[model samples]
Structure formats: structure tokens, C-alpha cells
Target: MGPPALYALLMLAVPLATIFAYTFWTQDGLTIDRTLTFSNYREAFNDPLYRQLMLRSVWIAGAVTLATVMTAFPIAYFVSFHVPQRRKALWIFLITIPFWTSYLIRVFLWKVILGYNGVLNTTLLGLGIIDEPLSFILYNANAVVITLAHAFAPFAILPIFVALEKIDRSLLEASRDLGETHLTTFLRVTLPLAMPGIVAAALIVFIPTIGDYVTPRLVGGPDGLMIANMIQTQYLRLNDAPMGATLAVLAMAIVAVISALVFLASRLTARIWA
Candidate 1:
């Protein structure tokens, strides 16, 4: 506890405290003024652009979380329940093959696949599926969601797989023996147990996706830009350290609130299942 606590204090708490302190100060020319002020927060809340970006970030992150979890669950279920025990590790290894490449490279590949004259449109054109290439898939919120969902799929799958693996086969068998259908057994005996993993996967995908500037910057175009993009602009381009810190703090607070809500919901669901 001593070493770990010290490590956290230095690595996590120190940086966060510094950022929090920065939010109260102002930047003038090249100098960071130590004068305490709440003007940064005021501007963050009052500005319509910042509000829109914040809302958009949350919406995109939520969509990415939902898509990733919904798709990953079935894959995880197949691997955990259907794959031969001896091959489970191999399947998991295959699932992580995407991580073997750099994340930036993966995002770039998705850009190519979804681009106007890219692989998907080319294939569609070759098959005579459409007269022209579709423009909606690559440079908008749809592209952001698609890219993030693919990128985070493995994170969602592994947790749900762990939860599914921990399910007692006897309980499922007993439920079946008592005349329950497979669907009923799954609903009553399996899903509640898997909720923890689902929650974990959701948080893992949502938190960072909200903060991701790269994917949005690369493929999100103008419409797909998020709060992180704004933060980067304020901090780097505008050289407004206080405003950037304020945005970062606000985003962190929003994520914290949402995470707490998810945890509470999990507890409530567990109690209901009990």
C-alpha cells in the first residue's frame, strides 16, 4: 500500500493537481499568471461552441460504447461458450491481432477503407451496388463511431469473456432441467452475471473515446470534432492554459459522474437479480 499509494500520489495526483491549479490561473503572452480566477469556467459554460463540442463528445462516446459492447458480447459469448477449451487462448490471441499494429496505423487504415474513393466504395462500385461513391461514411460522426468501435472492440470482448467464463454451467443446466428455455436461462441466470463485464467494457471504451483527438482529427472532419480537439486548440494553438485546463477538468468531471452512475446501476441491477 505504501509504495503503490506513493506512486499514485506522484504519478496521478500530482499531475491532476497541477492541471486543477492551472485552471485557476491565466496565461498572458508567454507567461502563466498565478492570479486565481474562475473566468475560464465561466467562458467554458457560456460559450456555445464549447457546449456543443462537449455534447457531441458525450454522444459519440456513448454511441461507440454501445456499438462496441453490443458487437463484442456475441463474439465473447461464442469464444467463451462455443470454442474448444484448448483453443480459447488462440481465439483471444486472434482477437488481439489488431493491437499488433500501431493505433495510429489502424485509424489510418480505417480512413482508407471508408474514404470516398477508398476500398469499400471501390468494392461497391465494382459490384455495381451504387452509381457513385457514398460520402457519408468517412468524414463525419459516423466515421468517428465506426473507427472507435473497431479500435475498442477487443477491450470490450475480453472483459465480457471473463464474466461469461465465470458463469457456473450447473446453474444454466439446472435452469434448463426446470423447463426453462435457453433464452430464459440466459436472461435469468447469465445476463446478470455478465453485467459487471459489460459495465467495465462500456467504461473502458467510453472514457478514452471521449478524450480521443487523433481519430476525430484524422477522420472526424469538422462535424466529427470533439471536446478533446477543442482542448488541444485552446492549449496549443490559442495558448490559453487556463481555458484548456478548465475544459479538461469539465470533461473529467462528466466522465466521473457517468462512471458513478454506471456503477450504481450495476449495484441496483445486482440487487434486483438477487
Candidate 2:
């Protein structure tokens, strides 16, 4: 009754509690020791490999977030400002069409597009622009970033569009009335007003992309493997549930810190704009 008790209990509290307890347990061979200990957490921090992967995941997620927002903003602006009101629904519908397909399908499409003999390379090869198929685009952090940015594009666009749409037309007119150019009005008024949505989109895209296991697995070669992949290996393959839980909790903590920083930055931006 109080804020969907069953939902929170079954989904959040229960699973989190299990993971927390698991973090305090240790594994040896095929057996798990239920005795509570800090060894998992200890190993997580002391292990240099975990630290590097965590940092790399954060970096790739940041790249995806930046790329998604920058690309989404202009599309959102156009939908809010340039499109006829009657056709706005149509544009939004088209944006949502991709959602009807499977997420894996979209990712696989990117894989094919970026494959050695995939669409981009073949086209370039035919066009005589490149000497050989580009080798660096498909199986690295860049591919993971590109795949994630595309996967989360709609998430970024919707919030930003909502923010831009909510802006008062009168404010723009007033700016023009005071002799401000379009660019000046945009920088001075539009962008600042839309910071909340931009922030929302950034957090939304960044958090999940960092923990994204599949994108990195299919597209990311050994070098592009993220922390999530390691977590999965511990849980599924390595039979080390405690270590996996430790990595998971540590990842959540890092994401929490990053999210907090973003929230503080947004608050400061709001204060300055005010």
C-alpha cells in the first residue's frame, strides 16, 4: 500500500539484500562459504584489473552520454521549433518505430554495419576512398560507445524534446524584441532553461551504458570488455557469486558518486540561471 510495498520488496530490497549478503561471503572452487567476511570487497579494491575496467567503463559511458546528448539536442530542437505542430506527432512516432524491434537486433545491425566487410567498408571500398577496410571501428570502445549512443538515442531525445517544448514562446519573442540574435537567445535562454532535461538524459544514458554487458560482448573485443562483462563472468562462468556481487556493489557505488556529482552540477547550473 505504501509506495507499492510488494514491488520494492520483491524487486529492490530483496535482491539488494541478497547481493549485500553475498558480498560478505567468499567462494572456493565450486563451494560458497556463507560466513560473513570483507574479503570480496577487499579483493575488489586491491585488484588492479577491476579498477582499470571500472574506470574504462565509466569513460566509455561518459563518451556515449556526451555523444547522445549532442546529437539528440539538435533533433529535439528541430522537433520543438521547426516542425509544424500538426506533424510533431508523426516525427515522434517515427522515432518510436525503432523501439518496436528487439534491442539485440539493433545492436546486431550495428555489428554488421561496422563489420570488416560490412556496409560502411563495402561502400567506401566501392567508392575508392579507402585503401582497405577500416580495422578500428567495430571491436573497441568506440564501437561500444557508438552502439550505446544509438541504442539510447530515443531516451536522450524524448526528455530534451519535452524540455524544449515546455519553453515559453513569449520568452523568445521578448529576447528578439530586445535585439538579441537567434544564437544569443538560444545560449542565454533556451539552453539554460533546458538543463534539467539535458541532465536527466545524461544520467539516464550514462548509468545503464556503463553496466551494459551485451553491447561490449558482441561488439567489444577483448580490449573493449567492460566491468559488466567481468561481473557476468564471475556470476555465470567463474562460480564466484561473492566476487560478482562485490563488483556489482562497487559499480553501483561508483555510479552513485557520478550521479551525485551530476545532480550537484545541475543544481549549480540552475542557481546560476536563476
lDDT of the candidates, in the order given: 0.96, 0.94
Q: Which TM-score value belongs to model 2? A: 0.97
Residue-level lDDT tens digits of model 1 in 81-185: 999999999999999999999999999999999999999999999999999999999889999999999999999999999999999999999999999999998
lDDT of 1 at 65: 97
Measured against the true structure, the TM-scores of the candidates, in listed sequence, are 0.98, 0.97
Please provide, for model 2 over 205-252, each residue's C-alpha lDDT reduced to its tens digit, 9 standing for 90 to 100: 999988999999999998789999999999999989999999999999
Candidate 2 pairs with clashing backbones: none
| Model 1 vs. true fold: TM | 0.98
lDDT of 1: 0.96
What does the lDDT read for residue 190 in candidate 1? 92
Clashing pairs in 1: none
Q: Residue-pair clashes per candidate, as listed? A: 0, 0
Per TM-score, the best of the predicted structures is 1
